[model samples]
Target: MTPSISVVIPVFRSRTLLPHLYDRLASVLDGTNAGWELILVDDASNDGTFEAMLALHEKDHRVRVVRFARNMGQHHATLHGIKRSKGDYVLTLDDDLQNPPEEIPAFLAKVDEGYDLVIGKITGDKAHSLSRNIASRTVQFLVGKILGKPKSLSLSSYRCMSRRAAEAMGSYSGAHVYMPALMLGSVPADRICNIPVAHHPRLEGHSQYTPRKLLKLFSYLLVNHSSIPLRFMTIWGTLISVASLGYAGFVLVDVLANGSAVTGWPTLVILISFMSGTILMSMGILGEYIGRLISENARSGQSPVFEEYP
Candidate 1:
């Protein structure tokens, strides 16, 4: 029988928190007295996370584990879990215990209210670094703007989606998978809602998402999710071209009026440098899109290989 809810957690370098998370999650689900399953995807963790997942799975038939051959980022691992889930409603949460299992009831309550997708918006201070918060908010803002998310809607990692929404989202086979972006793009704005959820301080290791990784993530979204960058390049290139032509006309008139046959080397040098830089910048944006296309074409095997499963 299919479970009423499937909780998906992407396990990275979180070996220490697994047992506690499982215990809490088990108690929480058991209290509901509804059929439920837990899907934990080990994202190629070098730590002994896979072994721990195996132990958990061995102890509980409801717990299923998926192991990746290589670290393919959080979105990929979560996508794998979503695909393997047998629940009518799918919930994704971080393994870091920061998003407490205690909040599951609230999420489920909201889900029962007929929202196709419900995101657990963090209420208080998140235990992440300032830089992470800034980067995350920036990404969220851009995603909201590009995806036309409602001003009231704020996407988070801790969220629940109906099975139809999950299946629709899982159908996307793009190499660069931003789960929030994909969800917003696939599902209608009216069907999504945000519920306030408690966020606790992290009880363990450092975050896997470094600033560099965040920057790369933003870059991917910029290139693949929207045509804004290309449009910006177009607008800037046109402005530069028009300004250069005007400058050229000014120089020609100045030389003509002054009756000087010698060209101003400095003016010519500046114009050439400016035009060269613009051309290179435009080419670089095009190259980024082309690179993404090549990657998507070359990509294969969407499912992460399972080391073990129930």
Candidate 2:
């Protein structure tokens, strides 16, 4: 039977937590009215998480597994599940066990309210470092600025999307694919809602979302989703050029008035330094955009799955 709901969890070095997660998911999903399936995408964990996924699949027919050939990022793994899931509505959550399985019903309840996408908003305490929390908020702010999502809308990995919204994402082939950005573009803002969900501390392992990865994600948002960087560079260059021209005019007028070359080592040094910095900054932004374009042209997000379990 085709499942009415599909749960897609992207696993990354959570071997110790898989068994408990599977059991909890089963318990919560068993009472649902609609048929459901668990689709676990192993994001090439160096640990034995893939083996555990295979074991879970063998233990339960509803558990489906996809093992990636290489460690594609979490979003890529989620995209793989989104494309392959055979359910009317798909739910995606992390495998770190921070997002409780019990909240699945709340997400479903929100979806029943006619929203095309219902995100599980983490209202409870998140046991993370101060830096991590700040990074998350920063990313959210940038995403809102670039993708035009509501700054108030707190997006989590745990969200449910209707088939229509999921299908809308199929047309996207960008390398740095942020699922929430694509989702915001695909679904109307009014139709997207959030439900409060409980959050727990990590069960065993630390999060893979290091500071570096969060920065990388931010960079991806800047380069892939918006041209703001390029626009900023253009504006900066124009302003600097105008200022330089004005400064030159001032110097010319001073020389003509005094009948001597306006000579100041400090002024020359400052102008030269400012102009050089502006040029370098503009070049760096342009180079970043060009690099993104080249990567988008060369690489497709369609990662290869080395194995699958039915």
Candidate 3:
């Protein structure tokens, strides 16, 4: 029977949680109206996650396993699973138990309301660190400003997408995959809805993401998804020029009114330093755009190598 829903879980050294996760998912999906299939993408997990998945598949026909040749990022694994899915709707979530399997029904319920996307929003205390929480808030703020939708909600990896939304998202190929930004670009904000989901402490290994990774992800979003930084530079350059002209006028007025030299070497040095810094910053932004173009071209020339599952 064709599955009505495909649940894609990207696994990377998450073997310990698979048994528990699979059990919970199987139990939750048993009573649902929608026929379900689990798409487990093992991103070259060294922890024998592939073996576990194979064992599960042997016992159950609804489980499908796709093993990657090497470790791709979580987004890549997600994309791979989605591409391999054969269901009318797709749900992507972390392999960690933090996103409970029980909440899958809630997501499906929201999807039934005719929304293209349903995101599980984490609110209140959800076992996230203070630093992570602050960083996430900052990312949400910047994403909203850049996308020109101040109210655009921040989306987690735990989301449900209609077939149309899934296919639209699968077409996007970028250096970094910011799902929220991609969804916002491809679908209207009103088409998206959020339901609060239960968050649990990680039952297995630690989080793969670090603070540095978070910053790099944010930088990628800023560079690729929005031109706000470039626009900010333009505005800043104009303001600096106007300020310098005003300073020059003040100096000339002082010279004329008091019959004295208007400045010292210190003033000249400060002006030169300011201009030099501004020039470097402007060049840096240009270089970022150029680098992205070059990278895109390089990626276009090559096919993504993947190891076939045995």
Best by lDDT: 1
lDDT comparing candidate 3 with the true structure: 0.77
C-alpha RMSD values across all candidates: 6.0, 6.3, 6.7
User: Model 2: which ten-residue window has the lowest total lDDT?
Assistant: 298-307
Candidate 3 lDDT over residue span 1-310, tens digit each: 8899999999988877888999999998887877999999998989788999999999898999999998667877887787788778899999988998898888888888999888888877666778877887887788777665437465678999888777767666665666666667666677888888877889756778788778777876776666556656766765665576566667656666875544574467456656765675676568557656745653453333221267
Better of 2 and 3 by lDDT: 2
Candidate 1: what lDDT?
Answer: 0.81
True-structure Cα RMSD, model 3: 6.7
Candidate 1, 1-310: lDDT as tens digits:
8899899999998888899999999999999999999999999999899999999999998999999999889988998899898888899999999898888888888878888789988896577898888887888789878767787887789999888778877776877877877787667777789999877888877889977778778877877666677667666766766676667667667766875565676477457856765685677667567656644542332322211265
**Full-model lDDT, candidate 2:** 0.80
Show model 2 residue runs off by greater than 4 Å.
260-310
TM-score of each model, in listed order: 0.86, 0.84, 0.78
Q: What are the per-model numbers of colliding residue pairs?
A: 0, 0, 0
Which of candidates 1 and 3 is the stronger one according to lDDT?
A: 1
Query: If candidate 2 were superposed on the true structure by all CA atoms, what would the RMSD be?
Result: 6.3
